[model samples]
Target: MNPDQLIEFLGILEKLKCNTRHNWSTSGRQESVAEHSWRLAVLAMLMEEDFPELDMNKVIRMCLIHDWGEALTGDIPAFLKTEADEKTEAGAIESLLEKLPVSLASGYLAMFKELSDLTSEEAILVKALDKTETLIQHNEAGSETWLPLEYELNLTYGDEVCRHFEKTQQLRDKVREHTLKIMEEEVRGHREK
Candidate 1:
């Protein structure tokens, strides 16, 4: 194991604790990427009870590192993502992984790739939970924190996410209901002006 290189990777990861997401907290401060990942890991552990068949280890690992690319690329909201953005993020992840010893780096890259590909069951669950957690955070962050997607939430959370991971349907439905309500309020306020 290349301890020095691994230490460098860890140092780089420390930046995530300070790298804020575009979404604001109820306190009006931007949420950090590390905060998001930590909560996602907690959710993954608790969610294991709901899916006894899948590997929780894999789920937790993916949750921890899924956004590591954002350390370099920043948290590009899914609605705003483009093929070019995706390519850039992949390149950033590839460069970061190069800092580790080959064997360990391969394992981490494989885990990250699985989430990117959304091919395995565990990867799908992590992805769904990631979205669900975002919805929950938005809900808790107050009405002022309404979703900003140009498209309807139903299109992304309902038709797309649920179609792939049916288990997330309930959460997606709830988030959709809340987001749509807030969105209407936003429109009404704008019209009154």
Candidate 2:
């Protein structure tokens, strides 16, 4: 909760990937896990006006730690999955959360639970914003590989998925446009290289 936690959180940053898939950036432009959460928490505050009914507290909390599991188990590309991988990440979150004092820990546990449970409007929007941010990143980075991006988009489904949100649905079109532009540029760069 103090400045020190922020510093310690950076150690976990090495593990989080900005894109689910590895691409052009050598370091993956991969944000450290803590930065991702911190940024998303900001996103929730600035953008929750879009979801007026959402519990802003839960949105902030969920955005803050949706990927702490990534801190322990490492991030996975959205397109690939194994039962073992999922379990390992879940266990990592459990272990990491246990390190917190009871006073500080309970709140994180509840937020993590909310993300997993996906029961609230706040959780839903936080989840949507998570995906939305990544897509925005991909477009900004102008990634070339369509398969990975396409694969990631294919992974979401039903109500729990972020793509279910209307704002993101429109944003999804933006993802496609930005991705296509990035791809075109990459192709040109590759030819010159």
Candidate 3:
């Protein structure tokens, strides 16, 4: 790509740094889309050893770009986002990809297709990690940040995808255990109050 195209693409990605997700940080503020993607990529990197059969690089790339569409549409909480919202985000992704050179755009389009279809092991791993990352963020955000519905969501949100792999399923079990502990603590605290 030319320098101008590179600059334009970088400029567009900057929006991800500014677009906040529904989840809050432990520091008492909303997390940005970029922050979530960065951590998700890092999480995939950290899991490289555990998933040697898959392409960790592809999984990392998926984590990084999975939400690039949110840079345009902003984040709709997973629980509240409808099928229409998903289509809109997909359109936004297409629009963004159009700005790139044919070579780059084609590669990203393939990745997006694989991700949306969840047909490959790498794609499935990324999806599972994405949901795991969100659940971990919610737990870190503390109970006060949670909506009433999240009490249940925190426990059940990623069960299906995580179940696709034994390791991911084990990870989900640990996360669910933590969610249960948090709920139990909340209940005990309320009773004390």
Candidate 4:
């Protein structure tokens, strides 16, 4: 909660990047670094309550700080999000946190580490929430929306994901139906004469 450290952190956070497919509100408008983090946290809260077996507070902390590294490495797109890129970002996070006070650095580093999935539970929880956000956003966006142009999944990971996570599974299926079935009607509402 140190103002000096927070200001530094926020400055770093401003440098974070996100995927190109999912734009902020307007087509040309871009989402901010803070906006990405906040939405992920919201996704965690929305989905975590259904996982009665795990610690969601941990999930919230993980999602909130997941891209603090992006403050250092910039957001890597979902398609280009490679292991080497992650390794590079990892190094950046470790170095940045080292500059902060020990107490703050310790907590920040721990949250960042959770994204690495040092353990099965932590890895699964973070992955589920991360994928869940994209899945739901995809449904909401439909074919006309921009993301479909850039991102692609093999279906294996997605099928496996929805298979294990019931809450997301419901949304995953629902998003498809809603987008496919109602998209035409929605467009018709705003169509030019």
19: Cα error in model 2, Å: 12
Q: What is the lDDT of candidate 4?
A: 0.65
Q: At residue 10, give the lDDT of candidate 1.
A: 86
Cα lDDT listed for each candidate = 0.80, 0.65, 0.94, 0.65
lDDT, candidate 1, 1-60, per-residue tens: 767876888899988988998567878888999999999899889877777889998999
Better candidate number, 2 or 3, judged by TM-score? 3
Model 2 Cα lDDT, one tens digit per residue, 14-113: 4564323332223445445556567678877887677776678777877877887876666675557688887787788888766666777787877777
Residue pairs of candidate 1 with colliding backbone atoms: none
Better of 1 and 3 by lDDT: 3
Q: How many clashes in each candidate?
A: 0, 2, 0, 1
Model 3 vs. true fold: TM: 0.98
Model 1 regions more than 4 Å off: 147-151, 154-159, 180-193
Model 4, residue 159: distance off in Å is: 3.5
Q: After best superposition, candidate 2 residue 29: deviation in angstroms?
A: 4.0
Candidate 3 regions off by >4 Å?
Answer: none
Candidate 4, 10: how far from true, in Å? 2.4
Error of 3 at 183 (Å): 1.0
Q: Which segments of candidate 2 are over 4 A away from where they belong?
A: 1-28, 144-160, 184-193
**Tens digit of lDDT per residue, candidate 3, span 1-193?**
9999999899999999999999999999999999999999999999999998998988999999999999899999999999999999999999999999999999999999999999899999999999999999998888999999999899999899999999999999999988898889999999999
